[model samples]
Target: MTVARRLIPCLDVKNGRVVKGVRFVELRDAGDPVACAAAYDRDGADEITFLDIGATHEARDILLDVVARTADQVFVPLTVGGGIRARSDVDAILRAGADKVSINSAAVKTPELVNEVADAYGRQALVVAIDARRVNPLDPAAGWRVYTHGGRVDTGLDAIAWADEMARRGAGEILLTSMDRDGTGEGYDLALVRAVVERVAVPVIASGGVGTLAHLEEGVRPIARGGGGADAALAATIFHDGHFSLSEAKAYLRARGVPVRATEEGR
Candidate 1:
């Protein structure tokens, strides 16, 4: 049986306010994270991801109180990332009600952390977040280097190789975000999405470059059913700008012959 495609709405929180910007610059407030999440939940969002963009470098905690509050009111699954370093941090977030914990810079800095968390919390509860920017075409060796510290520093690691390794280490899923396409509203980097999807056995949540319904359509095209395409697509700026609702996006995908979540059918 073919599983339906997933639609994820990302909340980039900083100082308790939902913020978003292009290439991680010029941040703008979106709204209250809890309120935005609740709206998405009511609209039939498959899952919601909260990224604490400043927590890591600032040495902050994963705002378990906010996460717990959001989880309490929202019915859908919630994935929390940012500032998750140790197993205790993971425990706090999960205990606060997050369905999964996402680790990026910390996981890259200490590869064993992925295994450690997966061993304790089970693979399904661990998500590896990869922030990648297209390397300068001139520097062929810079292909897909991972970014850290809120995309300020480059780790010099090949994304595909790292993704493969994380999967081998028992990562349940990969959240791949393209810095180049983020907040551009142009479209997702299909090449980047395809590369990561082809290399990892786990599910790939494509982030960045979602401006229109077409971009959403393109994001899930690679996972099409019956050799056709996948169902849902994720967006931040598009949805944040109030261009479309989650239900509307699902209806559009379904009309395009994609298999979206069945519950989203008449809404």
Candidate 2:
């Protein structure tokens, strides 16, 4: 049986404000996280991702308050990431109502951390966030490389290979974001999404470059057909700016023959 593809709306929080931009640079304030999350939930978003883009190297808290407030208001799943470096940090976020905690730089720096969290919180609760950018556009073999520290620092690791290793190490899911497509609204990097999806057995959530319904359809259909595509597609700017509601996005995908949840069918 084919499973329905997921649609996720991402909120990049910095100083408690939802922000987004291209290449993880030039971030612009979108709105308050809690309010934005509530809106997405009401719009029938399958899940929502809250990334504390500024919590690293500064704030030690994992935006528990934001998570708590959002959980109180939203009915769907919530995945929290950014500044999740320690086991306690993961615990705090989960306790505050996050369905999953995504780890990036910490997981890259200490691969064992993925296993540790998976063992303590269960595999389904752990997600490895991979922020990747095309460092060498001229080289077709250059491939997407993982970036850490809120997409500011390059890890020099191949994104596809890293995704495979993370899955082997017990990561339940992969939130793969393309720095090049992020906030550009041009569309997701289908090539990059295909690369990671083909290499990993776990679910892959494609992020960045979802400017229109067509982009979302492109990302979700490929994955629903098989690993050679995207299982879910996430957006920040498009959803944040109110270009279209989550319900509209899902309807568009379903009409295009993508296997997406019909939660928005009535609405």
Instruction: TM-score each candidate.
Output: 0.87, 0.88
Candidate 2 stretches greater than 4 Å from native? 20-30, 56-62, 223-228, 264-267
Instruction: Give per-residue CA lDDT, model 2, range 1-267, as digits (tens).
Output: 498889888888887666753222122333667777776776778999988877554443537777888899898889998877788888888999999999998999999999999999888999998999986755536798999875789898989889999999999999998888887888888788888887989999998877888888888666456423777888877776666778888778777777777773533
Question: For candidate 1, which ten residues in a row score worst on lDDT?
Answer: 21-30
Clashes of each: 2, 3
Clashes of 2: 3
TM-score of model 1 vs. true structure: 0.87
lDDT tens digits, residue span 70-128, model 1? 98999888998988878888888899899999999889889999999999989999989
* Number of the predicted model whose lDDT against the real structure is largest: 2
Please identify model 1 stretches exceeding 4 Å from their true place. 20-30, 54-62, 137-142, 223-232, 264-267
